[model samples]
Target: MSEPSLQHPLTGKRILVTQADAFMGPVLCEVLEEQGATVIASREDIADPDAPRRIVDQAGSVDILVANLAVPAPSSRVGDVSAGEWRDTFATMVDPLPRLMQAVLPGMREQGHGRVLVMGSASALRGMKRASTYSAARGAQMAWTQSVGVELAPENIQVNLIAQNFVDNPTYFPPEIQENPRFQERLKREVPLGRLVSAREDAQFAAYLCSDAASCFVGQVFPVCGGWVNR
Candidate 1:
């Protein structure tokens, strides 16, 4: 194994991070910057139809695109899933991905190399209660990634995803839940790692994957759920 160092393989790389104010954006930006990357943080929600293209257009010559998309996890039962809910979830998570890729591909193709990493969810990997819409949307992201990864591999542009759950973040495991003893017990009983994966751990992994060192990984769904979704 290689010795650990503070310097990241992404040193000097120009990376564009989407949804920069939410989800895993802040931490991802922090870690990527710490590793010497010049991060272009886009605070746009990306729900607007033309936002993806505009964002990519705004950031020209990007070496990496971190599609860090996120929305509130829907708790409506599969039977109670409404058309509006389904459409909205897909709109929030799935639709923008292709647009973003298409917009950025030309520049990456020009450069002859690039990386696209999707910040996704583990709920898509397994059946979860009352998360049908959210899981389906996330699954769509992964499925699109799988097809695109192979398509872009010839251009030396890597597309991949990090399907994660049960991590220490403000979105899912908020302060109130973390303070609950029951939640802590459940965390220990459920996750094999026996705790929430730190934000830095997850962010660092993302940084490495976006780096040149992770070129071998393509269209791969790496679970960062601390063994929560072992399958």
Candidate 2:
């Protein structure tokens, strides 16, 4: 670990990162902690309606909530999308969102300040073949962030989403797939960055957002996809 900065942006802040073992959760937790946050890393299943509140309650007072949720993206075409896939995707990614808000908002309100950052996907930003179900769920997450971000801004609570794609992580881009020649060609043809965004780069930005410096942003969907959204 690098030496701690003289001024820790997240010093004394209590951050709760959900689904700590998945998607961007591990990196987010690692970066936030390095920045001096007391992190509550939970790897619980939040699909149950009560799980969100339970997790929040167990963590007690939270200064920031990182809604880092994910599941294996399904590539079923629109015509082949199963009802089960749709329900499960939303259940895992979308459903827990509002429940988490409800659980944490009251505590934040009492404190007069809070931050909620959703780790979402850019699949919802652009069209992709055979991603109907996964995209819709991610799209719902983006929409929810926009709506709730505005609603909570007046209360000094900031809600935002990071719509990311083509980032280097084991979940979406494992080593074997990244080493493939065809995948390299795709990177050249697609991502403007011509490479996967480093996981630390992404996590560092997330840490900044969770810090006090990001108070001006509200309900914004920042794309961190190596310019993939534009392509």
Candidate 3:
């Protein structure tokens, strides 16, 4: 069957997406633009101290903010993890998310409308053997997203988390993980669909959640796991 044409229910809206250089980020930007929304794509690493200011300077008025940058954790046991490694992982995966949201919240409040999509991982729901730090950070992100969503609901600024499964995008998976045969077999066996989720599929859902159609969904962690969690 021919694919359906991309359509945006949020046409004419202004959207800002961080980590635009990432695979999913660009896909989202293109989809939003095709749907009639004015998209401001930023390649900023939100973990950087100066990133928030740079994004604000570039996208003057952001009606939607998608925080989608994450640093992969180095494989190590809890006891063997170094202090610097822990700090770096926390900064990249946990910090900056709230800071970025704070930068855009005032303007959204003024307009009485906004949508914040925070990308998390399915690993947060299920523990991975060597990914303790990464899982913890994602769990924290989901909790933070919920709190912010509740706080901003009165102002019509909805915040939600997308807990993604093993998406079949190079950017989503670290090269080292992809190179591991045992991990690959585990993923194939665990995921009910027997395959990785597609970037386009996740992007499509994100586009909808950021639209008026999903106005009622707030502070919720929506899973796009392809039945991985169930197994």
Separate clash counts for every candidate: 0, 0, 0
Of 1 and 3, which scores higher on lDDT?
1
Per-residue accuracy of model 1 over 99-121 as CA lDDT, tens digit each: 99889988998889999999998
lDDT of 3 at 218: 87
Top model number, lDDT: 2
Question: Per-residue lDDT tens digits of candidate 2, residues 1-231?
Answer: 333354678888899999999888888889998889999999899898999999999999999999998989999979999999999999999999999999999999999999999999999988999999999999999999999999999999999999999998878898999999999999998988899999999999899999888999999999898886253
If ranked by TM-score, best first, what sequence of candidates would result?
2, 1, 3
TM-scores for all candidates: the values are 0.94, 0.95, 0.90
Best by TM-score: 2
* Superposed Cα deviation of residue 66, candidate 1 (Å): 0.2
Model 2 residue 119 CA deviation (Å) reads 0.4
Cα lDDT tens digits for candidate 3, 163-221 = 98777555657578777898788777887786677778888888888888889988999
Per-candidate Cα RMSD to the true structure, in Å, reads 3.2, 2.6, 4.0
Q: In model 3, how many backbone clashes occur?
A: 0
